[model samples]
Target: MTVDIENLIDGESKFVSFSEKISLPDAYSVNGDVLVKLSGKISNEKKGLFHFSGNIVAVLNLNCDLCLKPFNFKLDFPVNELFSRSIHKKDDCLSFSGNIINLEPVILDNILVNMPMKAVCSNNCKGLCEICGHNLNESDCRCEKEHINPKFEKLKALFEESENE
Candidate 1:
């Protein structure tokens, strides 16, 4: 959705409320849709700079990094940004030239930044067994598991002997 900044600037409106249902494209692999809510107030911070500050709330569907299980992640945070008719190299802000502002990227970027680097269902997730590539959380393996490195057998024997003593 696009916010018509030019219209807002020229009018007497001081604040704006926006809500949108955003779904990622099939090629962009996030699990589910996002509901983004933004309420911002427009202010003239400097001579002509339009500063917008607001709150953004979103629910993102993410997956467990290790087990690849889907889960819902909630994001509620503040957004402080500047929208300008031209680019400002030194200032930290988003550029908008025309009447339209494509807020999708801004909303998406904010949500993504809050995403966990390593998402897990829980701390106790058993995860997949390294030896047989079996999902330990789902089931157990009955077949005797071999050591990843054959040389570890001697060390295993030593450890067993120590435990016996």
Candidate 2:
């Protein structure tokens, strides 16, 4: 959703609340769509700068990286930003013009940053077996495994000889 920033241009501090429901496009490769709620206030600071701060809440459905199972997760983050007349960096500060503020990129970037790198369906997931690629968490497989490296067998024999001695 496109947010209009013209109202914030006025020389008055106002409370503006907006809620947006967006679906992750196919490009994102997300398992399911998510609902995002954003509400905040915009105020004009000294000079032609504006400040937008608020809270963003969202729920996402993603697949566990380990188990490949789907799970729902919640995200709650606070939004804080400073705008100035021109984009400049002095010491440690951000500035933007008061006439126009594009919030789409900011919102999207924040949400993406908060996403978990490794999502899990449960705390303990057995995951898949290496032998036959079977989902061990679902069921047990009886496939006989073979060890190709003969050096490993020699090491096992050494351990067995030591135990016997």
Candidate of highest TM-score? 1
66-152 per-residue lDDT for model 1 (tens digits): 667776667789977776665553367777665666667777777667667777877887777766767777888664666556678
For model 2, what is the error of residue 138's alpha carbon versus the real structure, in angstroms, after optimal superposition?
3.0
Q: Model 2 reaches what TM-score against the true structure?
A: 0.66
Sum up the clashes in candidate 2: 3
**lDDT to native, each model:** 0.69, 0.70
Compared to the true structure, candidate 1 yields what TM-score? 0.67
Q: For model 2, how does the per-residue alpha-carbon lDDT over 1-165 read when each residue is reduced to its tens digit?
A: 443466654566766565666766553336445677888877777566677788878777777777677767788999886666654644333544445566656667678888778787677887777788887789988876575588988998999999999
Best by lDDT: 2
- Pairs of residues clashing in candidate 2: 83-96, 84-95, 84-96
Off by over 4 Å in 1: 6-13, 25-29, 87-91, 143-165
lDDT of 2: 0.70
In Å, residue 140's CA in model 1 sits off its true spot by 3.5
